[model samples]
Target: MSGNARPSLTMKSRCLLTHRAMYGAEQLGSLPCVLHTIDMLIRDDVIWLFWFDHQGVIQSFGVKFVQHTPMFLLVLMALQRFNTANWGLPNGLPHGAPADEFVKLEELTAEHSTSDSQSSSISVNWSARTCRSLHFVGRCTQIFDALVRRRDAAVAKLSFPDVSRVSEAVIVQRAREVQTAKFDLQRHLPVLHFVADVRPQMSAIREFLNITTDACVARLTIWEKLTPIVHLRGADFRRCWFELIHAHHLLWNHGIRHLDPSAANMMVRYVGGASRCPQ
Candidate 1:
C-alpha cells in the first residue's frame, strides 16, 4: 500500500489512474534490441498488472475498463446485467456479489483456461476497477510477481522414430553459445535466443509491446531445428545457475527481500540447446 494515505479518488481521477497505471510500462517483445532498451520514464507505482499476447506483445491493465465507466461502476452494471438475465448469484461470487456484478470466469489456476476444449489458448479477466492495486500489494508482500501467458509456438506430443540426425558435437557448440551470450537483466539464466538477424524482426515485434527493460522482462525460447522440444540444464548451464544466485544477492544487497521464490517465480526456459537460468 502507498504511504501517502490520501482520500479515495474521485471517479474521473480513478479513470485516469487506471490508464496511467495500465500504460505505465512497456512489456518486452520478441526482438533482441528491445531486450536491451529499458524505459523508466513510463514506469511508476500505479500499474496494477501486466499481460502478454501471443506475438509477445504486452498489455498492462489496471482495474478493468468498461467503455468510459470506472471499474466500480462497471461492477454494478454487471450485477444489474446478471439480475436481468435471471441467473442467481453463484456460490463463488467474491463477497456473494451477483453473477453479472462479478461473473465467475473459472476456478482459478496457473492461467485461465478459455474453455474445457481449447488446449492451446488462455485468457485472463481484464477489469478496470478502483480497488487497491494488485501488483503493488504483491510487491509489498515481497512475492516474486510474474505475468505468464502461453503461446502458439510449435508443440509436439510424440517423439520422432527416426534417428537419422543425432549429433553430440552440434549440441555442445550451441550450448556454449547460449551460455556465453552477453545479456543485461537476465544474463546467464538460460533464456537466450540466437537470432541470425534481429533488426527486421525487432521492428515487426515492436507493435506487440515496446521492447523496454523497465516494462517487461525478455527471454528467448529457442526451438531445436530438428525437433520441437528445446533443451535446458545442459552441461554449460552452471553460468545461469550462478547468475540467479548473484541476482538474489544483489536484491538482498539493496535491502529488498523476496518473500516468495517459488518455482513459478523462477522459471527456466531453453534457448537453442542450453537452458535459461531460473529467476
Candidate 2:
C-alpha cells in the first residue's frame, strides 16, 4: 500500500459499505462514511449512526487498524493487560475502548506461516452483509442546502461593478469574499463532540491496493450544521450583526484590537435573556 496514491474507494469497497450505518432495521444514505487524513495518510473511516427519532447523529464511531509493528502490538497488549487487571472498576478499562462499542477485526487469527506480504494484508469487506432496515438522513443537509440557495440567490441579485449605496468596487470585493467563503467551505470538514473507541480485535492489517497500512485509531464525534451570516435574514441577521459588534467591543475593552472580522468564520446561535457567548 502506497501512502500518496488515494484513488476513490473501488466499486467493491463501495458495494461493501452498503449502509452508512445499520440501526435496528434502518439503513441510511449512500456511503455515509468520511475519511480522516493526516500528513496525507489515510487515518480512519468515520461513520455516523442515527435514529429517525433523533434530530442528528445519535451516535457515531470510527474504525482504524494498527499493523506490522511489535511496538504497537506491545502498546495494545499493555492496555489489554491493564484492562484485565482493572476489570472490577465501575468504569470499563482505563485505556480501553468506549462502552457499547465493539470492533469485528478482519480475519482475527494466528499469524500465517508465510512472508510479511501474505500475512500482513487484511481485507475488510463490509458491503457483503444484507441490511434488514433502511432510513434517510438529509433533514439537516436539506436545511443547509435551502439556506445556502437562498443566500446565493440574494447575493446573485447584488449589483456588482456598478455604483450603489456602497461603492461598486466594494461590491466586487464582497463578491470575491463570498467566493472565498465558498472555497473555504469546500476545503474543510468540521464536527463536534468526541468519544473514542478502539476495536477489540483491531490489530490486523490486510493487504489492499493503494491503501494505508499504518498504526491508526478511530474516535467518534457529533456533526454540526453551521449558519453563516450571509444566510441569515430578518431578526436573525440583525442578531449576528449585534454579536459581531458586541464581540468587537468586548475585545477592544479588554485592551485588544480586533481587526479583520470576516463573515466566513462567524457562526450564529440563538439565545434569549442572559446569553453565554462561546468563541
Candidate 3:
C-alpha cells in the first residue's frame, strides 16, 4: 500500500483504537455514546475474531483493557452474588418477634413451614429459637451439610441437558433456597462463643474468631466514642446497633432485650454490641 494512501491498520492497532473509542465515550458522560461504542466493540465479534490469527498465534492486543474489564466485571458479579446470597423473606411481624409470645416452638416451626412454602416445594421446618440454641459444633455441622446440598444441587442442575433453558423463576427459587439454607446455618450462632469452645478440628475456627472479634470490638469502641458526638437517642442507637450487627428476627427470638440506657451497659460488650435505652 502506498504511504500517501495510508497503510492498513494491524490487529493490535485496531484493538487499541477500539479501547480508545470506549475510553473516550466513557469520559464524554454521554450514555448513548458509551452504548454505541460498546455496540461497535461487539459488532461482528471483532475483538474475538482477531484474538487468534491464521498462524494460530494468539493476538495479545488490548491486553490491558481486556484483562482489567473481566476483573472489574468479576467484582460487579461478586457484589451481585453477595446480594442474592444474603437475601431472605421479609419479616412481617414487628421487631421480628413472633406474633404469639408464648407459642409452642415446635408447633410454630411446623406452621411457619406451611405458611412459607407452597405444596410443591420442599420446606425445612426450623424455629428461630431452635436455631439460636444450637451448639457451635452443631452449627458448623449444619453449615457444612447445607453447603454440600447446595453444591450438589447446582451440579445436578448444570448436568441436565436443558440447563441453559431453565426458567428464570426456577433459577430464582433455587437461589432463594440456597440463601435460606445459609441463613439457617449461621442463625443464632455466636462467633465468640463458638471460638471459645475447645474441640478437635477447631484451631482454624479459634484463630478466625480471635481476629474477627478483635476487629469487631475495635469498631464498636470507635462507634461508642462517636455516639455522643452524633447525639443519638437511646432507641435510635439501639435500632442502629441491631441493624448493623444483628440478623433480623434471630436476636428477637432469643429473648435478648435492649437494656435501659446507662454508662455501665454502654461499656458491656453484648453479642450485638453495647446496649442502649429507648428514648
- Scored by TM-score, the top model is 1
Runs in model 3 lying further than 4 Å from the true structure:
1-15, 24-239, 247-279
Superposition error at 262 for model 3 (Å): 27
Better of 1 and 2 by TM-score: 1
lDDT of 2: 0.29
- Candidate with maximal lDDT: 1
| Candidate 2 vs 3: which has more lDDT | 2
Query: Each model's TM-score, in the order given?
Result: 0.23, 0.22, 0.16
lDDT of prediction 3: 0.25
Model 2 clashing-pair count? 9
The reply for model 2, stretches above 4 Å from the true place, is 1-30, 34-194, 197-217, 223-226, 234-265, 272-279
Local accuracy of candidate 1 as per-residue lDDT tens digits, 27-90: 2111111222211112222323323222222333433223224654654575466441122111
List, residue by residue over 1-279, the lDDT tens digit for candidate 2. Answer: 234332344465444334323432232222212111001112244222222211122222221323324544554575567542122121122222223322222222322211221212312122322221232222111110111111211010101011112332232223323322222321122222112222332112212223233322222111233446666767766755666666555445544443556676565533453222222
lDDT of candidate 3 over 1-279, digit per residue (tens): 122332344687577656754454333222100001111133221232121100111222222324347744664475466421122111211122233222211111111122322212221212222211111111111110011111211000000011133332332233333333334413222111001111111123225435331110000000111122134456765654453344334333444333343332232213355543211
